[model samples]
Target: MQFKNRPNECVTTTDGREVWLSRSVATAVCILLECEGRPYILVNQRGPGMPDFAGYWNLPCGYLDYDETTAEAAMREVWEECGVNTLELLAQATCEFFSAPWDVNSTPRGARQNVTIHHGLFARVAQLPPVSNANNEPDETTDIRWLPLSDVETLTFAFNHHERIADFLAHVEKLAGISYR
Candidate 1:
């Protein structure tokens, strides 16, 4: 099926360029697991070929496939990327994020004027199977690991992912009624 443009979705900039306006909902699942008897969040660094922020480490994230719900997308991304299949939805953040093409005029394949809506969800699990580089999806990532939240602050993340992860962590803490930091 062809993607229809939303009403007033495409807006021409002052530079006189026509671009497509596409909006997609994505899920970023924060999965916690015990490694070496300590709690760690599953994080990943996209391979060097990704169009976005390549090789940047962040949480498990992906766009919602057609006919998939938010929760299902979350679980699927976690499982496909990190080999974690079992997860319980803990909390969904209050705010979602929109990432639109900053340079619509120059972006290739008319992907420039698109806006992406990102949903952040927290997931808990007993443990994770070993992260494998088994799937090939564009720049399929390989350097997957479990790390403390503090590590997130020090590492470089794709887009505003670190902030989003921080937001989810805070939301989880609020839901638990205690500060885990």
Candidate 2:
């Protein structure tokens, strides 16, 4: 059966059966760093006037462009939102996928019916790099920070990022053969 007035949302298969389109794919980057022998992760505050979760903190993330791989999209989002070049930094990174469904009435702009694929790009660093937009123009992020893992529980995270952060930390703990608690 064809969906009425929603041609883009449905497609006919070779067997002539109509199927709903798959969910959109987005990428979320978890840039892990080590500072002063402690672990930190990159996060950014959504700028004011954002369609969803404005003023709340989130990982450097965006939708995957049609011409790029998920890894490339993650790296691009990192540079765009945090001004950090991840091409060299992500040599040792790992990736994970997660499914995120928006509330019926709470879908954000550009992310309706999308599923986020979380990418964890962990790196060891001695110092934090300064973050600024390459074009010196305002964008989606208002603040960028390298937050200590121990302090992550105290902040409000957007897009279910708190769970994503926890998962990353758990993975780190498993790799390091240690547990936080």
The candidate scoring highest on lDDT is 2
Predicted candidate 2 versus true structure: per-residue lDDT over 1-181, tens digit per residue: 7653334478889999998876677888777777677878889888875778989999988878889877777778888888987765655343222122111222335537666666665556667667765621365878888888888988899887888777766765666544443
The alpha-carbon lDDT assigned to residue 155 of candidate 2 equals 86
Model 2: lDDT equals: 0.70
- State every prediction's TM-score relative to the real structure: 0.65, 0.73
* Total residue pair clashes for candidate 2: 0
Model 1 lDDT per residue over 41-109, tens place:
778889876677777887787777889776667667877777755343233222222122111111223
Question: Which lDDT values do the candidates have, in the order given?
Answer: 0.59, 0.70
Q: Which residue window of length 10 is worst by lDDT in model 1?
A: 97-106
CA error at residue 81 for candidate 1, angstroms: 1.3
Model 1 stretches astray by more than 4 angstroms: 1-21, 34-37, 88-128
- What are the clashing pairs of model 2? none
